[model samples]
Each structure stands twice: as C-alpha cells, then as structure tokens.
Target: MKSLLFVMIAGLASAAMLVSCGGDGSKASASGPFGEIPSLVSDFETFSDAKRAELQGGGEDNMKKILGEMKAAEEKFKESMNAAFEKVKGKEVVTEIDPELPLKVVTPMKIEDISVSRHLVKLVGELELTATAIGFDSYEPTDAFELDDLVVLSYDNNGKPFAYDGLSKDMGGEPMPAGSKVPVDTHIHIESYNAASMGCLSKILITLKGSELYDQAKAAADALKGK
Candidate 1:
C-alpha cells in the first residue's frame, strides 16, 4: 500500500513537470493556436546549404555564373526602386486631398500623425530608407530633411503590415500629385503598390475617407496604437 501511494505521487509530480516544461513558453514546442512559419534565418540557411551542395557537385564556372546573375538581378531591382523613389521627392500631400500615393517604406522607419476625414485621410510621417544608387542627387540631404515621399501602413503585433489586396491593386498607376486636392470616396484604400511582389514591406498608405470603410481605417490605426 505504501509503495503504491508513493508511485502515484511520483507519477503526478512527473506529469505536472512535463506539462510545465512543454508549455507555450518553449519556442520549440509551443504551437500557437496556429503554428508559426520558420524564421528568416532558417530560410536563408536552407538556401545556402542547397547552394553549397550544388557548388560541391558542379564545376566552378557554373557557380560563378549563378552568382553573377544574382548580382545583376539585385542591381536591376535596386535601379527600379530608385526610379520610383525619385518621382516623389520634395512632395507634400494632405491626407484630406485626393488620391495621393503613399511613400515607400523600407526597414527601420517609424510612422505617425494620421488623421481621417469623410473624403480624406491625412498622414504625416517619416521613413528610414537607404539610398539604392550612389549618384542620385536627392541622396545628399541632411538627416532632418532625409524623409522623402512619406507612406503609411498598418502593422500588426507580429510586425506584419496588413492591407487589402484589392485596395493596393487599385492604386496600380502613378498617384495624383502631392498636395493636389481631389475629391475621394470612402473605402480607405492603398494608393501605391508593387503588384508582382508580396508587398507587405512595400510603400503604401491607408486612406480614412469613404463611408463603409471608415471603421476599417480606424481599426487599422488602433492596431498600430493610434488614439
């Protein structure tokens, strides 16, 4: 009888220990309500390992050629982004004005001072984008004056920027000039985007005008901690 009681207590303690050890606090074992995707480092390492395997099995010339192509593609992408950036420098637009495209946002930028009206949503913010090309004249600005075309996006707790695909697609072309007052309808839409890419980090803004979509804008702003 004594031995059985001791075993039962030991079993309960072990079970409790296991529950605590395997709780949601452990990243390796903690699955959220939905599981998480692997982090960026895991993705990079996977690609790097595959590339190394190919290099070891193949000729040096092929490896060199592949690297060169990667470099060229990166250069072309940077050039295109720089061209888009150049078109918006020295521009200021009121949120209440017509459909003005939002400015581009790279990493390390903070967004703020957003207001909404019936037909306009005013966004005043700054960005922290690096110069894509060296020879551009606009790159030589003082730190205080560094902000170019300012764009805004609503970010969620996971650091992911969220906006509707339809809205972003609607602003496919060049947006109206900054500060140009144009009458806009409701539906808080995005005014600029890159359609081909997964545009979570792309330049975009959320409008606060229109009738039915007002709540969405407010929700987005609230998600970003706006009062």
Candidate 2:
C-alpha cells in the first residue's frame, strides 16, 4: 500500500513538472465561432512555423484553399501595379514653345501674358505688329503694318497642326497708319476645338500675311541697297 501510495505521488509530481515546464501561456481556441476561415497573412514572419502550419490546418482541401487565396491576393497586387504603370506611361508631356515659330519674329508685338488650364488657354499680346518698310518713300507700304489678315495654327504634342483658331481681335482690315501698334487679348476653349488630330494643343503659331506688299517692299529695299 505504501509502495502504491508512493507510485501515485510520484506520477502526480511528474505530471505537474511536465505541465509547468512545457506551458507557453497561450490557450488553443478557434479563431472564429465557426470552424476554419481562410485568412490573409499580412505578416507571416510574425508567426512560428509550427503555429503557421497549425493555422493552415491539415488537409489537402485546406492547403489548396490557402494557396488559392494567397495567389489571388498576389495577382490583385500585380494588376494594380500594372494599371498605375500604364497611367504614368500615358501622362501628357508639356511643351513650352514652338521653336520653328519663335516669339522673336513678332518682336514689337510681344506676348505679354499667357495662361493655360485643362479646359482653355488665354493669350495677351500686342495687336498691331509693326511692319517697317526699310526704304518705302510713300505710305503705300503702310497697310501691311495694319495686319488685316491674321491666321492661327495650333499644334499638338507631336508638332502636328490640330486647330485653326481665330483671335478675338477686331482688326478686320480696319487699316492703320504707318507704324501704328494695337494691343489684343484672346481666349481659346480647348474643349470646343473639334479637329481630327486634336488631343491637347501644346503649341500655337500666329502668322500674318500682307500679300500686296510682299514684292513692293522688297523692291523698295533692293533699290535703296543698290543706290
């Protein structure tokens, strides 16, 4: 009886030692009220290998489900990345000015202020572009300085003509005296520009032509040069 009592006491002591030594304070409880639910492992590194395996559970079906969820999450992330990449690639490039049509050509008729927005553009400049006839003794060459005819050429990012916009100025061939100057302001509504090659107008070219004075002015200047 004493031996039996000793054996029972030894077994109880051994059980207590085992319980105290191997305890990790955590208790086994289902993550949810139901059974297993597929979960996203945001920080898989935080869990031990054994704990992670236990969370995944022990079945071919469970393993497949976990892998499928992870794969789906990875694919979703990749798709979003690709979408952002495409947006960056398609972003519009800005153009400052058209080199072929420099502002210096209209020297005295300068562009004072310019504003651009997503929808429209506003431009302010001198209306009357000065046309100096070097050696014209008569006022016949003065009409070219009036700029009765003005044409605008709008270009896109690719330097292709997009819109043929008209200025709001009322020059209308109103006829100005020799060396007369006029100031003008104009606005262009980009949305209203209905052209085949139109996307975003990156450059604008303003041209003035005095068809009648072209040969006459050159002849006067050449005559003066020869003398």
Candidate 3:
C-alpha cells in the first residue's frame, strides 16, 4: 500500500488537471474571433470539497472507492487522449504507468529554465516540502528529506501522458528545522524525439516523496477515517 501511494496521488492529479482545449481552434459563441471557446477543465475546488466530505464520512471503503474512481478516470483519460492524438497525428502513442516507489510523497514544485528546441525541452526547478516527524515514538529530531530522484509526468493539450524518470545528482537538501518549508533543487530533460510526436507544452508535473513520512501520513489519514 505504501508503494502504491503515488499511483493513487498521480491518478488524482491527472484526473484533476484534464481540461478540454477545443476540438479545433474555433470560437464556441459568435461574439469573438472564434466565438467563446468552451472550458473543459473540471471545477477542482468543487471536486476537492466533495472529496473532503467523503473523508469526513469516514470509512476505508470510501477511501478505496475514491481510488477506484481515480484509476478508472486514468484509463479513460488515456484512451481519450490517444484517440485525440490519432485524429491529429497518424501514429499510435503508448503511455506508461509509473510504478509506485518505496516512498510516496509529492510537494509543491515549480519549474524554471523551460526552454524548447525542435526535439527537446529542459528545465531547472525545486520542490518545496517540509521534513516531518510523526508518531511520538517514531519521531526523529534531526531527520532530513533526501531527494534521491524526481518523477516527471505531464499531458499535452490533447491529454497524452508523457512520463520521464529524471535522474539527478545535483538535487537534495540539508536537514532543516522540523516542519520548515525548504526548496530542494532539481532538473529535467525531456525530448519529443521527433517533431510529429511533439505538440505544444500544456502542462508539467513533478512528484517527490519520502519513505518514513509517506507511511506516517497514510496512517494518519486512516486514523481520521476511524480505520
């Protein structure tokens, strides 16, 4: 279960971030250049509140149900994305599901130095996270969050999932005061490999997690549900 936390989180993220761009570059309503383009992005605030309500209702089954929805959404999203790409480009694209690592944690991350060439994109960035100690008996006062590697995933205007396992030796941070927000630097090098496979960049995603902390958080969540 600990190893699969990210699969669940990424499912939620992917399910959350999918917004419709347009079938073609046309206006939906007649007042503007192409009329008003309709927004396909789901209302996240409302979605989030509903999820919160589910949590408050308190059951492991409820939690499992949400994860089930996320997995279903993931499969559906990938299918729709491939279908759309087939319409735009003639080749079939294969999307990969990242395995849940031993540690599952994601923090607020920002991408910088995003540059694009005919076949590649590169960037420097950092993840904002706090080192935490939980379970009075399990707390360690001097623990530091060690960033071993970065997991990258994203979708284009068409919803195709592009995931890259970004390896970095230059990213990590020193142990800081407990619960202090710190920025751990990282980088990514993504290449489209060919022009036809590459579309305009619509979104970028990064996830980082710690072993002990990830399990700790899950326990807390389960406890909240009275499990």
Candidate 4:
C-alpha cells in the first residue's frame, strides 16, 4: 500500500514538471504533444487521493483497482508522448563539433533518437571525447575535464542559433581523461513548439562550457523572448 502511494506521488511530480503552468490558477492550454497532461494529472491526483482515503478502510479489492487505474493512466500518457515523438523520427540535424573548441570529438555526434513533451525536445546521442592542450588550459589542466563543462547550440532552418536548455551525459560528474577517447551518452534539451520542426534542425554546435560562443548563443536564444 505504501509502495503504491509512493509510485502515485512520483508520477504526479513527473507529470507536473512536464507541462507548463498558466499565471492564473487555471489549467493552461497546451500547444504541443502534452496537451492532455494538465487534465490527466488533475484526474489522476483526484482519483488517487480518493482511493488513498478509501484505503484507510482496508479494502484489498480497492487497492487493486487503484493500481490498475494508475497503470492505465501511465500507459495513456506514454502513448500520447510516443505518438508525438513519431512525427519527427526521420528528420536529421547536421551536428558539428566546433574545430576551434578545446574538446575533441573522437566520434561524430548524431541525433540517434528524440523525445518531445510539451515545449521540451530531448535529443539523445553518443559521442567520444578527449581533451586538447587548449582544453587543459581552459579546464584547469591538472583536473579531469568534466562532461558538464560542455555547451550545446542549435540552429533552426533559417540559420538562427539558440542555446539549448540543458545537457546531460553518461560520465557526467567524472573527469574526462585527456588523450583517451571516452564514449559518453548525451541527452540535450531545447525548447520548441513541436517535435517535427525541432527535429529538422539545420545544425548543432558543441563547444566548451563558459566559452564566449556560449554567451553569444545564450543571448541570441534569450532575445527571442516576447517575439
């Protein structure tokens, strides 16, 4: 019973973060893949709360029914997200590891898969990394260069550049040793209206974090606000 409650709470938290909230205390109209998320989350919350309260009366059949409902809702949510992601499956983006950058890309980065929900687009891929002399200087030569010290930039079809929302790699916090090729799984986030257009990206640039290029890209992405 406790385990079921924990799962329900976790699902709620995950769903809450996946959608945007309106300023007023009302459900915001979604414009992307997760259009039904707000209502789904609300329904699940209400249903779970009612079920939890009933569980206090100790009914095994009630608990089983709750579990079945939870699973159904979860499957429905996944189907919605999966269908949305399918719209962008074959679209390819040209990925480039900036030559002037300190980090050396031993393997070319490619968009192996994509996932979209609401305004967030996630790009997944694998790449190999090694540090150069310049990398050493930029990343404190003695210490291992961490994957978190990487920056990603994406451009639309019109060639307008924007900074990505965030990046995550397999060996995230660990130091990337210099002169050795290390394979890292990468997941990058970018904000967009839909998966199709975002998947058809013109280009993606990767550079060292905190570089001047990153600042410029961030500024460009930020300037799009209100427009």
Best by TM-score: 4
- Predicted model with the maximum lDDT: 4
Q: TM-score of every model?
A: 0.24, 0.30, 0.30, 0.48
* Clashing residue pairs, backbone N/CA/C < 3 A, model 2: 127-182
lDDT scores of the candidates, listed in order: 0.32, 0.36, 0.35, 0.51
Compared with the true structure, the alpha-carbon lDDT of candidate 2 equals: 0.36
Kindly list the per-residue Cα lDDT of model 1 for residues 1-227, writing each as its tens digit.
99999999999997754443231222211121101111111222344456667677677798897677545654654454344334433333222211332323222212211211111122233322122211112544432211222223433223334433112111212223333222221222322121111112233344323423434634544443323
TM-score of 1: 0.24
lDDT tens digits, residues 1-104, model 3? 97699899998876543322222222111121111111111222234446667777768998888867755654654454344323333211222222332222
Global lDDT of model 4? 0.51
Q: Which prediction has more favorable TM-score, 1 or 2?
A: 2
User: What are the per-residue Cα lDDT tens digits for candidate 4 across 1-227?
Assistant: 99999999999986663333321223433432223333334444455577667668767887787778767766775676566456544434456776764355555454345443333444455455545222223444444443446667766444656545444555533455556454433454433322222333456777666777777777765664333
Tell me the lDDT of model 4 at 114. Answer: 46
- Candidate 3 wrong stretches, greater than 4 Å: 1-120, 133-146, 165-174, 178-197, 208-227
Superpose all Cα atoms of candidate 4 onto the true structure and report the RMSD in Å to 1 decimal.
15.0
By lDDT rank, best first, the candidates go 4, 2, 3, 1
In candidate 1, which residue ranges exceed 4 Å CA deviation?
1-57, 90-227
For candidate 1, the per-residue lDDT at 203 reads 33
For candidate 4, the 10 contiguous residues with the lowest summed lDDT are: 19-28
Report, for all candidates in order, the number of backbone clashes: 5, 1, 6, 0
Measured on C-alpha atoms, candidate 1 has an lDDT of 0.32
